[model samples]
Target: MTIFACMPVFCAIPTTYLSGSAAAGGTAVINSLALPGGFVSPAIMGWAKTTTGSFTSGLYMMAALLVAGGLAVLLGMPARTLQETR
Candidate 1:
């Protein structure tokens, strides 16, 4: 369900900054960027669990990254893009 919502936003990114035609390539780039984190996140979480005996620190770190990414999108994207998306 979240993927349903996320893909359009994913597409919107390139459409916003570049062009509608760039979306497919942009999505490929975005997916590739996400690949590293997907691999690294679980290992980091596992390390946190082993070293700290809990997932709290790992979860907090992920949450912080989420907030930072959202902020970067909000600040970096053009104001008109926000209005058009709505």
Candidate 2:
């Protein structure tokens, strides 16, 4: 769960930094090619200027939360059934 929760923060740090660097130089990195031109181009430029970072980071964070929550639910299931039996 801890790892799951931290995955977003981990991915975000590098993604934000690299995007900012690319935008500042007005050059695209190979990874940036995967990003949508209309949406991500403007977003990366905005993030570079504002230092606010990527929406993808937020997505990663949400995914981490979901993974952590799912793990928690799975871990609790056995206890839940035990209580029901009692």
Candidate 3:
């Protein structure tokens, strides 16, 4: 679980930085500047109102979820292993 949780933290490093940059650049740059409704759409929707802060907050939540999901998977592995052992 610990290792799994850490994986998100590791993955988050780049995302965090990117999110910050996107936020600093504003929603126009984050959304319109990038691919047409490819990835920026979600970022814009998540950010809402095209604000850097909102985008950062949204990305933070996403990163946290990534960590949580990783942890869940990691934790589940042990349980599954134990079950098979039994």
Candidate 4:
């Protein structure tokens, strides 16, 4: 729920610098790439639960991945103004 709530803000991060066909193509590519993870992660979480016989580990793993993603955004993603990208 929180993830979906925050998606618009995150989505805006990329869209702000793109326009016209570039923006459309970039959005298409981003959705295409992101789709697989949406499918794969639940299966991975289910596997983790099955092997461990508890959902705790799976939840922890999800939390860890969330932290890693946050860190990636903070450390790896470069801050660029709209003018910079263009």
**Candidate with the greatest TM-score versus the true structure:** 4
Where does model 1 exceed 4 Å of error? 1-8, 83-86
Error of 1 at 36 (Å): 1.0
Ranking of models by TM-score: 4, 1, 3, 2
Give lDDT tens digits, candidate 1, residues 7-63.
577566775567665767887798898899878889989998998999999888777
Q: Supply candidate 2's per-residue lDDT for 6.
A: 59
Pairs clashing within candidate 3: 23-52
For model 3, give the 10-residue run with minimal summed lDDT: 26-35
Model 4 global lDDT (CA atoms, 0 to 1) = 0.77
Q: What is the TM-score of each candidate against the true structure?
A: 0.74, 0.32, 0.34, 0.76
State, as a TM-score between 0 and 1, how close model 1 is to the true structure.
0.74
In terms of lDDT, model 3 sits at 0.54
Error of 4 at 22 (Å): 1.2
The local lDDT score (0 to 100) that residue 21 gets in candidate 1 is: 54
lDDT of 4 by residue, 5-68 (tens): 7678667655765888888887787789779988878987899989999988988888888788
Instruction: Pick out the ten consecutive residues of candidate 4 with the lowest summed lDDT.
Output: 76-85
RMSD (Å) per prediction: 2.7, 15.8, 14.0, 3.8
C-alpha positional error of residue 54 in candidate 4 after TM-score superposition, expressed in Å: 0.8
> Over the full model, what C-alpha lDDT does candidate 2 score relative to the true structure?
0.53
Best-fitting candidate, scored by lDDT: 1
